[model samples]
Target: MTVFRLPDLGEGLTEAEILEWKVAVGDVVTVDQAVVEVETAKAAVEVPVPIAGVVTELCAQAGSVVSVGEPLIAVGVAENSETARYREEEQAGSGNVLVGYGTSTAHRSRRRARPTAPPPHGRVPRVISPMVRRLAKEHGIDVAALTPSGPGAIVLRKDVEEAIAAAARPPETVDEVRVPLTGVRRTMADRVSRSRREIPDATTWVDADATRLVKLKRNIRNTDPDARVGMLALFARICVAGLRRFPELNAHVDAERHEIVQVKGVHLGFAAQTDRGLVVPVVRDAHRLTLAELATELARLTDEARAGRLSPADLTGGTFTLNNYGVFGVDGSTPIINHPEAAMLGVGRVSEKPWIHKGKVRSRQVTQLSFTFDHRVCDGGVAGGFLRFVADCVEHPEALVTHL
Candidate 1:
């Protein structure tokens, strides 16, 4: 019997709440086949089996949270050359076998075992456990150079810890506080890192006279006292209009296929600060929704996010994002492009500012708008046009009527 641990469900998520099992004991499975659905703080993800075999055990039941490197399931397989290699991977915790969100892919075959030999003078040692790998990675230790004390020259956790201690023997030290990054925060960190690494992003900003937009909101509320229209919904409508004008910004690059995919409709996402963490709840088909409808949906999603009741579907598939950092009492931000999305528009706080209006200097309601775009999808011209259009609509709310 081989025990398979709950692999790190990307972004170094330490634990997941098991939602349901796709297989039970005695069920036959294939490599890379999803066997269970688990929920991390970020989203619901399906965990795949690393080795093909008959299920012998379901270690954790639904609604139970299992941490990384803990046994998830046990599979029974007949002894063979392939089984031996799979066992090696199971012991080593090869994370490549861990599938991505909601999908699985083919697993890479491991090399056949070589004759037993000592570690070469100038080679990295063999790492055989996830704990050791994580320990070394966290401490910036070169496992290859470490002298392993385990059998077959496998690097162990103690080896890594010892190396870390030796390197960190500081002459002067204070009590250090360590906070573990788990769940949503860890997932967010991973995505942000990937976005910065993969995206050639650029930002442009403009000061917009939001006096008309604010007045439009008041007029609508006056027309219908029960109308739920708010500043965020108005901004969502503006973003939808901007996307319709510049469809290029409503798309993502398919890095593997070497293609740019233009999304069909606007799935508008807005950043909301929730008790769990920061989450972007998507408003699907925002283009089809009326201003009032947009307000209603945004309000609903925000409530759901705050209550920590949002599901994975509520958080995925956003073609464009509208970030109102102004709610946090900030004036402006050069927002990061949400991974897989082409652009995001950030709104600063709307305040009374001195401005030239009707050819005269006056105090006007103004806000700064910052647009950040993935340069890979479009150049500065397209990004500039989208921001300019949004700003124009903000200055003259009636301009949206032409597009709506």
Candidate 2:
């Protein structure tokens, strides 16, 4: 019999809740065929079986949380057949964990520890590869200082050396009543804790006359239902322009290294509240996308996020963030900076308000724009300038043509 354990899905994840089983017992699975879907704190991921054989038993039922090294399935093997060959490969060779990746026997097995070394930073000195250990030793770096971006908190060499180079840096649970941090909520707590602890943040906000911008979106609203350019999309465009003006906010501080790290392109992350919880879905290269393109992507990602179908990649790699809290019927917010990124631009509700137009009192669509930034990156002068530029774009929508 060949046993398949819950393989480490990377990123120091400890356990995952099995959502569904793709196959039943007695069903045969080929190499790399997904047998189940498991939801981690990160995302709902489908787990694939490594070797091909008849399913002897399903150990864990749906909705049960299984630890990283616990048995997931049992497969019965036959000798003198194709299944036997696969079983041979499993025993003689490296066992595949994630789809398209394998864990070599040598990689999984541990070598004896050196006579003397630095004490473990965490609960235990994380099980890491010999090469990773050697690299840490050569550099005189603590393995514990190197955060684990690998499976079950094992430190990756890239994570360690990045310490050498520049260095760099949720689900929801519960219901109508009070709930506990089981899934996405727990994930967000850890992240927000890190963001608040490491970042020296500041906030600035201003109200803008968005009458022209509102009209522009309304005019183009029905032009293409597939690609609806709304207020958020326009604000996104303005943010792209703002980032161009103040590149400092587009950067992050390597706190350990005490150096500023500026990102290359703008992977714009927008906050979307879903049934699961608050999640940020990123649009890659927001600077290159047009208004319609940005709108389509926003709608697509928002829909996916709401449905809980967003992949881990869809939720990460944001160099800057654009948060539109106005949809919640609020006027302003002191947005918490999405960590690793230096700043977050928030937009409150755009509603009619009294304003002076041509020296006469009139009603205009005005909105509050708030910017929270890393004080380590720039001073109030730069933060103020970025927010003011956004306000200017809202007041004069025609400026977009020139800004673009």
Candidate 3:
């Protein structure tokens, strides 16, 4: 029997919560077949087994957190050349983790059943991932009845969600509700609390006439309809430019070192709300990207965030952040800074409002931009200047050419 231990996922992650097991005891398995899904502080990842054999034992129960280097699964294998080679690879440290490990194309047919008894049809549901199974099970929906929308006729999370929407849910009576914070939500709470406790933070706001920016996007689209330059991308460009002018805002207050380390490039992060929770995906080297390039990257990251496919590297090393709460149709918000990042810029909704244009009252597109920063990094004057620069770019996008 070969014991497969949980290797480090990445970014020094020490523990992961067992989401579900793909295989059970007495089920035959192959090398590199994903045996379980685990949720780390950063993201949800599938861990694969190295040896090819029968699953003897599962080390931990679902929903339990397992530390790194702990036994995850046990596989029984025959004493042959292949088994010896696998053991040798494990000794060399390549067989424990998924990263840098190669998977073989040779795999036998595998089968898995729900924790409960087989359905009336006596066939297992063709589900794509453990998450989809969990979603269907949570809603008490029959997985086999749900139509598959994913490739290869596999049931996806969206299919389960659609079924849930169509099915009427009966209201339940309950007392006070309590939810244990786990996974990403838990990490977010810890970071926010730490930021409030350690950093001296302040907020500043300004209302800008976004009519010109709106017109600019329309003009660009008219020239090339394929250019999906969104408002958030334009705001990202403006924020990157502002950071170039005020490098202090693009820095971290290293209390241990008693120094302010200015980050080298504009690794811009933006807040994206997913079904799991709020996640900020960072775009590295934003200063070097064009407006169109920024839009593409932002759209890609947003899709990855919503689909729960973002990796640990895609979510860290952010020097600054852009929060577009405008999507929620809110007027303004004083958001807490993403811990360790020096500052964050929040953009409110762009709505039609009465404004003075050329000394005359007129209806125009307007928005409020809120800036939050750690006071230890810079004074209010610098914060105000950076906010003003961003506002000016929004009001008069022509000024962006100078910064570019």
lDDT comparing candidate 3 with the true structure: 0.85
Model 3: per-residue lDDT, tens digit, 233-320?
9999999999999998999888998999998799999999998899899999999999999999999999999998999899889999
Q: Poorest 10 consecutive residues of model 3 by lDDT?
A: 94-103
As for candidate 2, its clashing pairs are 170-184, 171-184, 171-185, 172-184
lDDT at position 308, candidate 3: 84
Question: Which lDDT tens digits does candidate 1 get at residues 21-79?
Answer: 77777777877777787656455567777577778888986546688889899989778
Local distance difference test values of all predictions, in order: 0.81, 0.79, 0.85
Q: Which stretches of candidate 2 lie over 4 Å from their true place?
A: 1-178
Q: How far is 167's C-alpha from truth in model 3 (Å)?
A: 41
Clashing pairs in 3: none
Candidate 1: segments with Cα more than 4 A from true spot: 1-176
> For every model shown, what is its TM-score relative to the native structure?
0.57, 0.56, 0.57
Superposed model 3: Cα runs more than 4 Å off: 1-174
Of 1 and 2, the candidate ahead on lDDT is 1
Q: What TM-score quantifies how close candidate 3 is to the native fold? A: 0.57
For candidate 2, the clash count comes to: 4
